[model samples]
Target: MEWLDWFNDSIAYVEEQLTNEIVLEEAARRAKCSTYHYQRMFSYIAGVTLGEYIRRRKMSLAGVDLQQGQKVIEVAAKYGYESPTAFNRVFKTVHGITPQEAKKDGAKLTSYPMLTFAITVKGVHAVEYQLIEKEAFYVTGLGLALGKDMEENQQKIPEFWNEVAAAGRVQELLPIMDGNSPGVLGINLMTKEVQEKWEYVIGVASKEVPIGFKQYKIPAAKWAVFSGEGPMPYSIQDLAKQVFTEWLPTSGFEYAELPDMEVYLDNNPTDAKFQIWLPVRLKRA
Candidate 1:
């Protein structure tokens, strides 16, 4: 099946299980993808976290149930809320009113329509990328543990970079970059799954570990190196999203189980040409 079709089928399964205790793993299984990848892709493409999507969907349904004269407690129980109070709070947050208000005459109830995945032709421009293979290499520099919370991670990362700059360490690390891949890298290594801690490294490719710097080895593998030219973050993010949503589904390659690297071409943070290196391998026939 096409990736988009499989994704929509998984979403349909989610909708069917909304009233029951939904198993995210089962949903991902239906999509023939890992739960981690599925959640990440869903958040990127849907513009909402998987948890948020499920919550909003449940609240939307609760509003409908209340409007149909179902008891608030019954609706809450059906949606797996422990109590009507908890349900009301969530319902109000999503629909802008309490469940009781939703049942009132002419009360506007919010509806979260079932979500389906479809590929739209992004015809304006094509992404520029190249496939390359390399031997094992090392990246060495300062690293920090970033928490699972996406919003907090986004805010904290820039501040982390600023702190590194303030310490004047970039100059210290650059001269020692003797590896084949020539550039400082912003690497995110997924260390844990349940709590989802990302170990972020600001490092350059190197052969040996430099003093006072941590080193991570980049394993030998085939990589899809996607380049984008623009200002910080926005351009890189757009390019990455295109890669996951548009390219990966149809590329006949699967994400390799390796740490991805972001290569910053210049020191200018505002306008830099950067490349996102995604490790990939051809799918089995």
Candidate 2:
């Protein structure tokens, strides 16, 4: 699709300006879309912000420059870092070694290549979804800040769930679930400006908020609901990934700015089944 080409070309724009002062809006110019939507779409498709991608690409090349006898300060300045201290901190975080050590004999470094989006045959396993209209609803639960890094969220979310369950948070919220509402809801709520930054909340659907509970009102919208089976978290998580990586590009629907709802049906490990309600609307609707 032409959209895929424009998005790839935006990546090319970022790569070309890696060593210079990068204008983020220039990426939008290359893609022929607003800067906001381009970055928002990028976060959904790539699972990282455009800025984070640029940072990793710059650090990857900076590793090569350091190993080729460039001074740390020079490499830092070349990549738009203000100080060696800040550069060293980020370099070590990405590469697992100081920039000075990278110049030594046989130093190992991490390299994050530029990303590209494409549609490949994603295999025979079918991904199924349906469109439904839903009224506005509220969920009451505790939440944790979900940042842009997919890896970080993968680690944090399960720990958050564990903490919630161990503290009997689910039981406390269960007393109020409406008959129309599913049991405990695991919701991935994102901000309009940055889709990747989220607050993952586990709560119940209720109009009545308890004294110590937080309530989030999910606005009425058309939804694309998908079914998942097999296991907790992993199965649903994999389904969500497929929905984005495979279904979304070809689905002719863009996500509405709303929270995604995960409804767990039962506690059985072997026969687990759940539903994920993803807010969506027709591309031109």
Candidate 3:
């Protein structure tokens, strides 16, 4: 099956076995992709991490059962929780109430329904892109260790950028170049692990001249570049997500095992434009 079909199949499996213990690794195995890639794709497309979705779905069902006069322990057991206490802890964390309280007061709670996939055909928006084949370029910027939770990383990235700026290292480390493209840049580095660690750089691209800054050489490769005009960081990130979820699977291209780079065209956060370069190789039919 194609990669997009594999992703849809994985989502179907998750929906079918909502009440079962859905291990991420097992889900990735079924999809024939690494856990890191699976989780990243899930979050990019679904707008929520897999673990968060599961917890919300479980809690939503538990809330319904509680309202239906089912015992808390019974609902807990049905959802694969070993004990009511465990269920209660998770429920409180997600819904901000215990099972008993939710049952007695009919408190408001969050729900995460099963996801359904559909393709919508629309008029093409002009996407400014180029297939660039360039020699290796050295990139240097801030590097930090990311935790296992992808959601945590998403929330922390903006702050990380601010911290980099506050330290005044961005000025010294990543100097703006005199070119048509000049602005903040982000470089993501990944490894082969289920909970992969990534380093994000919120700096500008430079051809040369820098010390006390980490350097990474991006090898010569085919790149699909997409540009967007909007607010900084968020717009860049949205484009990245769309590339992984919408472009790669449908474009008949397989992603290369190399770091992706985002170059900020204009660095001002309020009025920013950026471009993303995704490394890919055409799949052999």
Candidate 3 accuracy as lDDT: 0.72
TM-score of 1: 0.81
Candidate 2 global lDDT: 0.80
Order of quality (TM-score): 1, 3, 2
lDDT digits (tens) for residues 207-277 of candidate 2: 87888789887788899989888866578767877886678767898766567778887766666888888
lDDT of 1 by residue, 102-181 (tens): 89989997788888887777637676779999888778888888754454565777898899989998888888887567
Could you tell me which residue pairs clash in candidate 3? none
CA shift of 125, model 1, Å: 0.7
lDDT of each: 0.80, 0.80, 0.72
Better of 2 and 3 by lDDT: 2
What is candidate 1's CA lDDT for residue 251? 83
Reference-based lDDT, residue 231, model 3:
76
TM-score, per-candidate, Cα-based: 0.81, 0.77, 0.78
List runs of model 3 lying over 4 Å from the truth: 13-21, 64-97, 104-111, 175-183, 193-197, 202-211
Total clashing pairs in model 2:
0
